[model samples]
Target: MEVICLEDAAFYTLIETVVERIKEKLSTTEDKWIGGEEAMRKLRITSKTTLQKLRDEGKIRFSQPEKKIILYDVDSINEYLEEHAKERF
Candidate 1:
């Protein structure tokens, strides 16, 4: 077995590529994503309530009884934030 680390830029590029592929697959469907607390914090730039609200409103995506998690579709969050980011800016 081999261990792959994300300390290198190449690894990030690979992650990006994979995320793009996943995004393409998800684009054709109306799917909800489950993001980690940190990523959600970064996306919303706020506390848990707002994030939960976004999830509740179906404006973003997630599940309840939240905990520290990382099973997110990064591409979906990126797209959602990019589309709605200016509201914060």
Candidate 2:
């Protein structure tokens, strides 16, 4: 085995760099809106009608900034899945 050491300042800098990278990764993954196709893929569904149904029924959250453009909330989709998840014995 080889030994390596970092000084106090260097060690703190390294830790800060790692924390910043983690924050970047988390912010990217926590995207607030996704297009219909991506939302469907994440929910493992193939029907636009079904997706619309869920949106219409208020089972999921979505936004329509324009008449024809829609974006689903990622957090709402995740919550929906967790709420409907089946329990195991």
Candidate 3:
């Protein structure tokens, strides 16, 4: 019984570690980019003005085409998360 529990715990830990690694890889993929609505959802913010503010502040890494549409890089998003994650309100 104890041995079974230990094996289960090890399996859970290994799974968690693999999941974390995959998440990191996905987050850092240079070609990975999400559109506006999904990006906003991930960031947990809905302010159009706030998005603009980030652009103006150069806090977000994005590409512009035509006149108005903005596309954000996944790695940049990850970097932003890492930078802002240290603070909590």
Count clashing residue pairs in model 1.
Answer: 0
RMSD of 2: 2.6
Give one digit per residue, the lDDT tens place, for model 3 in 27-88.
Answer: 87435766677667667789878876876788877787647777876677778888888755
Predictions in order: lDDT: 0.65, 0.95, 0.76
Q: Which predicted model would earn the best lDDT?
A: 2
TM-score of each: 0.40, 0.71, 0.56
Model 3 is weakest, by summed lDDT over 10 consecutive residues, at 29-38
Off by over 4 Å in 3: 1-31, 87-89
Per-residue lDDT, model 3, residue 87, is 59
Clashing pairs in 2: none
RMSD of candidate 1 to the true fold? Answer: 12.7
lDDT (Cα, tens digit) per residue for candidate 1, span 26-88: 888633454556656658566777666665676655544546553445565777878875664
Residue 41 Cα positional deviation in candidate 1, in Å, after optimal superposition? 3.6
Return whichever of 1 and 2 wins on TM-score. 2
Compared with the true structure, model 2 gives a TM-score of: 0.71
